[model samples]
Target: MITQKAKYALRALTALADADADEPVMISDIAAQQKIPKKFLEQILLDLKHHGIVVSRRGKQGGYLLLKPAHTITFGEILRIVDGPIAPLPCLSITAYRRCDDCDGEQNCQIRHVFAKVADATRKVLFSTTIADAAQPTHSAEVTRLLA
Candidate 1:
């Protein structure tokens, strides 16, 4: 399962996506609107800014905005940024692959085989779905179909 931090990051990104493209959103506004804690959101946004996913403004009218288009930012990208690898098992992770300590060989590991398929399917959906998609009202049906 994705961590709460990941969930909050997704929600925050969607909120940003829903805002005016040229306008910046204050952290307090996002925290209140999305029900995320202000302190936690500050940390999350700082991380996102460091990753180049978002950019911040300064001064009176200053705030935060997406550095890239919402459609170009995939859910998988955010999850990987906030939660690390998306795989269910270390052996199945594409970005952070490591052999299981107890496993003798990947070729003969039944668990790895099953989870590899799961990881592939999960990656397909997550990488294909974007922050813009999540902001849409009809995205649920499309996401469900992708999983199906």
Candidate 2:
């Protein structure tokens, strides 16, 4: 299940991605548009900025903008940033791995073996589908594009 924070992060990113890349969007604007709490969004955006996912500017017309292109930012990357490892189990994690206390041998663990395949498939799909894809316009344009 996706956490509310991670959902906010994805929605916020999609909102920003849908806007002009050259301009930054204010947190309040994003919050109102995405129906997210302003305070919660502030913290999330700050974390994203720290991770180089987004950048902020200050002055009269200041706000946040993507540090990289939407197409370059994957769902997996955002999820990993806001949440943690994509693996279902800690033992199956590549980036945040730790030996499962119940397991005698990692390679010999049947549970691990099954989940490893599931994790791999999930990771592949998440990593390939970018924020740009998620932010794609809906309605007739989306329908035509899908048909094409």
Name the lDDT of candidate 1.
0.93
**TM-score: model 2 vs. ground truth:** 0.90
Q: Please give the range of 10 consecutive residues that has the lowest summed lDDT in model 1.
A: 138-147
The stretch of ten residues in a row with the least summed lDDT in candidate 2 is: 138-147
> TM-score, each model?
0.96, 0.90
- Identify the leading candidate in terms of lDDT: 1
- Stretches off by above 4 angstroms in model 1 are none
Judging by TM-score against the true structure, name the best candidate.
1
lDDT per residue (tens digit) for residues 1-148 in model 1? 9999999999999999999989999999999999999999999999999999999999788899999998899999999999999999998888999888899999999988998899988999999999988887678688668768
> lDDT for every model?
0.93, 0.88
> For residues 1-148, what per-residue lDDT tens digits would candidate 2 score against the true structure?
6689999999999999998988989999999999999999999999999999999989778999999898899889999999999998899888999888787998788988999998988887778778888788643354344334
